[model samples]
Target: MIKTLMGSIREYKRDSFLSPFFVMLEVVMEVLIPLLMAKIIDEGVVKQNMNYIMRMGVILIVLTLCALAFGIISSRFSASASAGFAKNIRKDMFSNIQKFSFSNIDKFSAASLVTRVSTDVVNVQIAYESIIRVAIRCPLLLIFSLVMAMSVNFQLSLIFMAAIPILGIGLFLIISRSQPIFQRVYKVYDRLNNVVRENIRGIRVVKSFVRSEEENRKFQEVSQEIYNDYTKAEKIMAINGPLMQFTVYTCTLLISWFSANLIVSNVMTTGELTSMITYLMQILTSLMILAQIFTMLTIAQASGDRIVEVLGEKSNLNSGTLSIETVPDGSIEFENVSFSYQEDSDKLSLRNINLMIHNGETIGIIGGTGSSKSTLVQLIPRLYDVTSGVLRVGGIDVREYDLSLLRNNVAMVLQKNELFSGTIKENLRWGDENASDSELERVCKLAQAHDFISALPDGYETVIEQGGSNVSGGQKQRLCIARALLKKPKILILDDSTSAVDTKTDAMLRQAFKEEIPDTTKLIIAQRISSVQDADRIIVLDAGGINSFGTHEELLGKSQIYREIVQSQTKGAKVDETE
Candidate 1:
């Protein structure tokens, strides 16, 4: 764990010893001020020397002001350094997440990543601030003050020096025991955050089914676990506060008692005894700050290790060497393709699959669930790598081309259409940043969306609530289609895209698709057979393997799986060979 933390701290070379050095300057001022205070009290005040008192008094005041100014400056510098530090860490974490293979993502939940990036980053930030603030100051002042106190009178300082090391051992024990507890608290914190996020996102369902109490109970279980861990850690940490106070007060009593005897015996002047007593108090208080610093350092390190885990992940799909001076329309071919999410992966999603698609052709992929239909289409954009295959886009091996270039030519309307919180026009612009109003209207018309959009009070300017929640399912689908159309991609993929539309609207969409989409290669993944009946070719998948490939007419006459599906879904009316 300590190595993991040290590795993360080493990530930002700028944060290397420099940040700590700036912070140590603060410790210098903290120690200097207290010593000046002792001088003012003993040398200036006790001897009844007004001039000596004023001279030291002014010097102490200036140092106090300088310390205050330094504290503020150091605080600002620390905040700036930490802010950039956390930002760079999160940036790397996001980039790493994007690199992780789909299989890797399945091992962790979205809620877990959310907690790691947010709450965990905060813990690191707190640790960074502690380094600049209490952590450095306390330890430095304590060490320096201990030296000064011991120098003042060996016997009196002995009382404190003796107790402090014992206290130091006790502080170390508290930190070590509590470190594991803090990690557990963060784990439970992730679980609790997961429940809260799920509940809030699914609140409509809970309210609709009147299951609020059930949800509350579920939330309570996770929340209670988090509270228990936090309470245990806090309880353990709370011990240090009183233990420090007890040690300091005891040291003070011993010093005061010895000081009185020294002065009465003429072994020490009144001013000298007073100065020694003051230094003893300063030394003990500084050690207390050191105690808190030690405790927080342990926890911050745990948090930093998590941040490092995210930064270190590498994506499986590399942006290859292919550059597209010009895309060769939308031709695609797959040869001897076999793929699985794991090694020695015998559960092939596509086995010995050979297929070719030309520019301006319409292809439909039909498969039952678990047949890897989506996974097959996903490969075109390099979302996942095939375990065994050579995939070529535009007559070039996909791995030979830059990943971004391949994706730019392909537009995939995902099963789940996502829209950010923005105006309708703003969302549409994602496809074509420079698209004019006419270009926007052109895509909307092709998507069968113009009529409804015109009906809205603000038309294309209408503000959409987050995730397009304010829009109906069909409207959101049409808007997503419009957004895709605006890209003017060389290839378009519709992955079960029209599930929510009425049959009439679906036909209109297909008609508009045929008329307006300029002979680009189109891949349609559909549960509805009628949607793809007129396709130039249809591939039927069963049990993660391609069972047959032919025109709709050929499939209807030949494949049994295709026949069974046509029989079941076509309602006994003679299944149309060509719609």
Candidate 2:
């Protein structure tokens, strides 16, 4: 985990190294100040010599200013290094997520990934900043102060040695008890974020059903879980403050009592005693800082593990070594192909699917809810690798083609027609970044979208809200179809994309496909028989296998399932016409 995280500190290595170096310099200045003060009290003030006192005072001011300068420089470098480290971490995680196949993505939830990228990274950053600066300074300060104290009076310094174990043991107990609680807290945070995301996305449904009170209750439940956890962890960690204070006060009183006796007995000088007290404060303050650092590390250790999990995940799908690039035609063949979302599971989403689709053929796929229509098409673009057997696109194995090259030749417009927040022109350009205005207009016209687009005030330049919420459902589907058409792919798969449009508009879209793009292999998945009745052939799937495959008329005569669907729809259409 440490090695994986450290790789993100690529360009900031210099700043990371310099921060500790400057911190060392700052500590050196601080350690020397107490010694010089001892000299002023003993050699100058005791003898009533103003010149000596003034000389030592000037040196003290110079050391103080140098320490302040080093501190500022260290802080600046550490901040740069930590923030840069965080940026690289987020970038690396997001880039890796984009490469994940469907199965790999199924391993993590959307909310969990969001937490790992955002809140978890922030915790690790805080710990990193402390590691480079405070972690360096605290130990150095503790050791230097201990040595100086012993040099002044050895017996008095032993008091600090005894107090060290008390503080160490206390801190150890607090950290050990609270670390597990922090781990659980962050997991709950994922749930809290998930709740918020679902609430916002389905706000319309929530309001229509009058379930706002229910959502609020759910939010309060998750929020209270986080609050209760933090409260418990804090209660355990709260022991550190009182424990530190007790140790410091006990050591101080012991040192003062011993120093008083030694002074009266003429065993220690007043200057040495004063310097010893200063060193005591420095020593205790370092321990307090050490305690804080340990606490931070405990919290960060859990977050660091979560981040490393994402960075370490390798995508399951990879391009083959064959270096195949160009797809020869729209022809696709699936030979004994079977797939399961879970690798080792007996249940298959698609079972022994064998089919041949020639170039320029139009195929219609209709099935009940769980018949794996979308899953079959997703394999063509290698979105998910088949669990068994060979699936070929354009007479070449999908894995043999470069992932980018294969996906570029196959366009899929899914059931959920998504539109990003941008001008319509910008979203369409996703299909072909360098598409000309004429090319854009032509594709929109073919998809029956040009009329509506031109009717708007902004025409193609109109801004689409996120998820295209501002437009009607049919409009969003048409825009998505236009974008996919701009790809000009050899194979186009529409997974129930035309459900929102009326029968007349749907007919127009199918007609446009028949006339304008004759050579493109088209696969239409729809529930409406009217949508696919005129296709070259249609597929009916049942229970993870093809129940029937033939032209529309052939299926109506030979297949019972096809006859039932057609008769039911015909009756509904007649009733609507009479009404």
Candidate 3:
């Protein structure tokens, strides 16, 4: 909680300064108004002096108005400050997430990330705003009221001081007990959120498979666990209020009883006794406020720990310092490369792989489902560091080059093409920010997306839904292709991206590839034989190693796995006839 509070303070430097200044003025109002009340009670009302009452009342009204004005203004400052703090933290988290490798994202589920950004940030925001309410004003009132009470009557001041420590100790013990409970509560909260998010994303699949009851039962179990944990924490903290009230009432009764004796003995006046009682109320009020803030910290601390877990993870891949000016050419090589997700695991994803890709060549890669084809290409950008050997790009070790520069030189359209919610032109411009309509069309033509774009009512201005759910799979693939083409990269990789499109459209897209981006080196990972039939070279992967690497004609002449895949995917006629 302290860490989270400090983060907010650092985030909103301007608002932090302004908020405290206004809050100090507000505290001045709290203290001054109480003193005026005492003045009005004792001097004015006791003497029956109209002028004294009127003057003190007017001053009290002014202080009350100022306090109200300052308090409202300070609260606004807290709202603005807390909002900015959460926003900045969210933005940094987003940027950091973007920098994370696919491996990193896989470690923390999408649902968990959403929870941290949304719910966890909310915790910090509320904690920060509460600082102005309880953190600032409560302590100010506690200490100042003690001073006033002490100055009025030192003997009674001991009672107020004694009450404070009792309240603090009570808070300390409650938080200590509740902290562990809060941690478990937050864990349950994350699990509960995960159930909801998964249910939403997989609703279509769930309905299609008719597993609605099973999913609901799973959700109910998690929800019940969350509720139980929450109730436990709530129950632990709930005792704080009643215990505090009990202490306050008992202490007040004792103070009043003892003070009456002092007043009767002529040691204190009626006005003094009245003011002491009000001060006693203020003390209890501060203690209640303290308890609330203490409880908030316990919960926020749990949330902050969760947030820090994500922010502290070091990226597996580091972006290098290589610039565009330093790019040698479109050439790549892997030497004796071996990789495994676990360091201690003996099994490797890609083993002893030696390969060289030259400029302006279409290299087709094929593999069984777990053949490491995607993982092979993923290494070129150093998404995951090789356990044993080197992967080089543009004649430089990929690790030696800045990640941004290496990525900039390579354009990849994944098997799953995800589009942001934005205009068609905006989506295309992700590859090259300065790309013009003519440039967009040229790439779109190559990707076979030009016709679709032209047919849309808004043309380039047409808005796409999240994940391009509004568009057909093939259309989304083509748009992804166009985006990749817009970069005119040193190396272009399409990882079975055209699988969604029909053979005819695939053929047309291949033809467009020949006209535009003819100089760019291309690596096509395809399932269908026709897609790779015209390639300069085709590589087959099996059991984490290269099974065969040769021209399509050479592969047909020799490789059995390649032949079987082609046979299963195609029937009759010459195997390469479709291409």
Best by TM-score, which number?
Answer: 2
TM-score of each: 0.90, 0.98, 0.93
How many clashes (backbone atoms < 3 Å, residues ≥3 apart in a chain or on different chains) does model 1 have?
A: 4
Candidate 1 local Cα displacement, residue 274, angstroms: 3.4
Cα lDDT tens digits, model 2, 99-121, are 99888788888999999999999
The lDDT of each candidate is: 0.79, 0.93, 0.84
Per-residue CA lDDT of model 3 for 272-369, tens digit only, reads 87778887888788879878998897888888887777776668887665454566878888898888876434877878999998888889999899
Q: lDDT for model 2, on a 0 to 1 scale?
A: 0.93
| Ranking of candidates on lDDT, top first | 2, 3, 1
Query: How far does residue 32 in candidate 3 sit from its true spot (Å)?
Result: 4.1
Candidate 1 residue lDDT tens string, 140-210: 76677667766667777778768977897888889888999887777777788888888888788989999
What is residue 182's positional error in candidate 2, in angstroms? 0.9
How well does candidate 2 score on lDDT at residue 163? 90
Cα error, candidate 2, residue 566 (Å)? 1.4
Error of model 1, residue 80, in angstroms: 2.9
Give the runs in model 3 whose Cα sits over 4 Å from its true position. Answer: 1-11, 321-324, 345-347, 570-579
Clashes of each: 4, 0, 5
Please list all clashing residue pairs in model 1, or write none if there are none: 99-315, 322-400, 322-401, 322-402
